[model samples]
Target: MNNELTFVSWNVNGLRACVTKGFLDHFHSYDADFFCLQEIKLQEGQIELDLGPEYKLFWNYAQKKGYSGTAIFTKHEPISVHYGIEDNEEPEGRIITLEYESFFLITVYTPNSKRDLSRLDYRLEWEQRFASYVTELKSKKAVIICGDLNVAHLDIDVKNAKSNIGNSGFTAEERACMSALQKQGFVDSFRHLYPELEDRFTWWSFMAKVRERNIGWRIDYFLVSEQLQNHIIEATIEDHVMGSDHCPVTLKLAIDVS
Candidate 1:
């Protein structure tokens, strides 16, 4: 069996809408071992996807219709699958945890701070809870965390950084939360692999055709436990694959998923 495995995470904006925009084309082209998604904006029986039996599909839906949601399609069936962090009950369907032999895979669509920063306080609380939850998981086994973390950790993560300072995604508090997580025991896979690469972004605004100009933010990410750092081979952003406002971010690891 191949020792290396590729994983892909994308915030499809809305899976149903994205499918009309060529989601399946990109999904088949990548053929990753695990394909995780967020902002799926779906509920039960909303749509049917036939990815074939080789893959196991899991979905977490928000109680509200067409709102925050997530899903994971994996070729390997995990020992167990969990929705939400223990006892936290994230009813928005924002987190999915899968347990495998050597590691745990978690996909999260973190709550976004509203444009006016009205939700900033709630977002901060979530950041702490999520970081602590992942840390706890890391204590048991290596953890791979991915999806729209919704923060730009460094100035390099967003275009026109100077102008965007203190904005929702680039706020000092939000950035610090991400930094603290890395300082603990997790590594941002993309940044760790290409420390100085520039003009690399994941999410772009639909406003003003800015995506054509490559003006965007690298808010989506794949983070790995410190112990799994060396297992990373390629951490990449599929910026050209356009089916949503945010593109796919991939992590190629030298470790097996099962």
Candidate 2:
């Protein structure tokens, strides 16, 4: 059996819409061991996916209709499944955690600060709670966190970092939160693997053909515990895969789930 495991994360924007745009084609092609998704923008019973018999699906749907949500499709059965953050009510249904023998895999669709930064305060508060929850989990076992984090963590993470400074996703406060998370023994898998790679991004604007110009932001990420750093084999941005505003980001690790 293959010892390596493959994982894929994407912000589908809207599951129903993405399906019509070839979501299944890309899904089948990747054949990832764990496929996590964010911004599903749908409630329970809203849609159904035929991902074959090998995958088990877990979803956390937002209370509000057609809004923020998350899901995980995994080939391996998890020891436990959790939704939201430790019993605190998450009306947005932004997080889902699957516990395996060696690690806890969490997929989160972080709240955006919005264009006017009106939600910036709330977003920061949410960040604190999220960080604390993950830190607690890390104390027990290694963790693999993946999804659209909503913030570009570094200057190199955005196409026009200087020009975008102070913008919602590129603000100093949001960036600091991401830095703090990394300081707590987590490694951004892609950046760790390709520190100097540029012009590579995951999310792009629909305006003025920004995506075609490669003017995008690396807000989606796969953050693994520092202990798993050496296990990372490959990390890539699947920019060519088209289904939503954000393309898929993939990670291949040398570790075995079995």
Candidate 3:
């Protein structure tokens, strides 16, 4: 089968707040084939949403309430859906993997290293495990990995790069891990599609007037394995449409298997 699929990823900061702030409106407007989300911050009964009749919602909530979480809303059902990289150790709800007939979609909300870099070690471990997980998935089918990676890979990824060098998202070590992943044959879809574009960011700080100044980071991304790179028709930053501090990033691909 051959078809075109549109995928979108966004960090809503907090899903409940985003709903009140018009997230569902933006979601409908995008009308993507697959939708991925991060920072849901809820548990089983904390909140509920009427996602309508056409979509299926999958959620991975953090064991700790009002913390990290993720979700996927897909128009097409997957053969199987897995939460996190494993069964017993996935309490934070940081990752979800869906297996479609032709591809695997892995959505992640990478752990932030924190402003003081206290969680840097844990973040590093997560990256290693995540990279390994994706590599393993690639052995089966084409893969699309999307979510808040929590790092700015290049100097062009954020404003004031010089001053932000050692910051959690801009740290050299973090950037290197991202580079290593891309070198392992994953294409950062947006940058691969639109190299040299400037001031295009998906995430901005909530402090003060950062968004107005465009002092943001391109921490969110859509990455695909080499074989699927050619299938990508377009990758975009939906900066104009917003409900959270982070805007949506979408990938359009000429892909279908049915």
Candidate 4:
């Protein structure tokens, strides 16, 4: 039997809005074993998605209405599910973790620093806490983390790298945080496979039709523990299939959770 497992991660922007724009069509086409989503932008009871009975759904809703949120639909039931990082209260509902017998899967929507860099300090602090949380979990089992990390770790990740250096996603501080995380025994699946590839982005600006020009950033990612590096089968950016500003990123692994 094929032990390969397919995992799809997308920042839908708004799940309700994306659904009207053929989200369901693309969702079915992917047919992934695990479909993780970020920035769902809805509260509980606001939207009910019929992803079919084959997939079990888990959601982490924000305290604020129509704000940050995350969800995961998996074919295999998890041993346990966790919301947020550790015991801290996550008002924005940015994280969801599923624990299996072999591995732990986490999907997170990392906070954006904003255009004016007003929230940069808070975002940096959150990064440290997030790294700590995942590192602690890594001690127990292998980890697969996928999400819209809201930062372009390297110049190769952004189209206008020089001009956007001080910007929210490309700031030195944010890039350093990503580098630190990777140093802590994590490998960026896509970069590990194709380090020289460029102009391939997961997010784009809706204004000025920049996506047509391919002016975008690779903010979404799938990061696995260093131990799972050898099991990496494929990492792809589904840039053509999109209903939101961000497209889906997929990771194929040789190991099967079931």
TM-scores of the candidates are: 0.98, 0.98, 0.97, 0.98
lDDT, candidate 1, 1-258, per-residue tens:
439989999999999999999998898888989999999999999999988778999999988898999999999989999999766588999999999999999999999998999999999998888888899989999999999999989999999999999999999999999999999889999999899899999999999979999999999999999998998999999998988999999999998765
- Comparing 1 with 2 on lDDT, the higher-scoring candidate is 2
Assess the local accuracy of residue 120 in candidate 1 as a C-alpha lDDT between 0 and 100: 97
Q: Name the candidate that leads on lDDT.
A: 4
Over 4 Å off in model 2, which ranges?
A: none
Model 4 residue 8 CA deviation (Å) reads 0.4
User: In candidate 2, residue 224 scores what lDDT?
Assistant: 97
Model 1 off-target regions past 4 Å? none
Residue-wise C-alpha lDDT for candidate 2, range 67-183, written one tens digit per residue? 999999999999999999968689999999999878899999999999999999999999999999999999999899999999999899999999999999999999999999999
Encode model 3's per-residue lDDT on 49-130: one tens digit a residue: 8777889999999999899999999988899999998676778999999998889998999999999999999999989988
lDDT of each: 0.93, 0.94, 0.91, 0.94
Candidate 4, pairs of clashing residues: none
Write the residue-wise lDDT of candidate 4 on 1-258 in tens digits.
438999999999999999999999999999999999999999888887888989999999999888989999999999999999966689899999999877899999999999999999999999999999999999998999999999999899999899998999889999999999999999999999999999999999998979999999999999999989999999999999879999999999988695
Question: Which residue pairs in model 1 clash with each other?
Answer: none
Model with the higher lDDT, candidate 2 or 4: 4
Positional deviation of 224 in candidate 3, in angstroms? 0.5
Candidate 4 wrongly placed segments (more than 4 Å): none
Q: Judge candidate 4 against the unseen true structure and give its global Cα lDDT, from 0 to 1.
A: 0.94
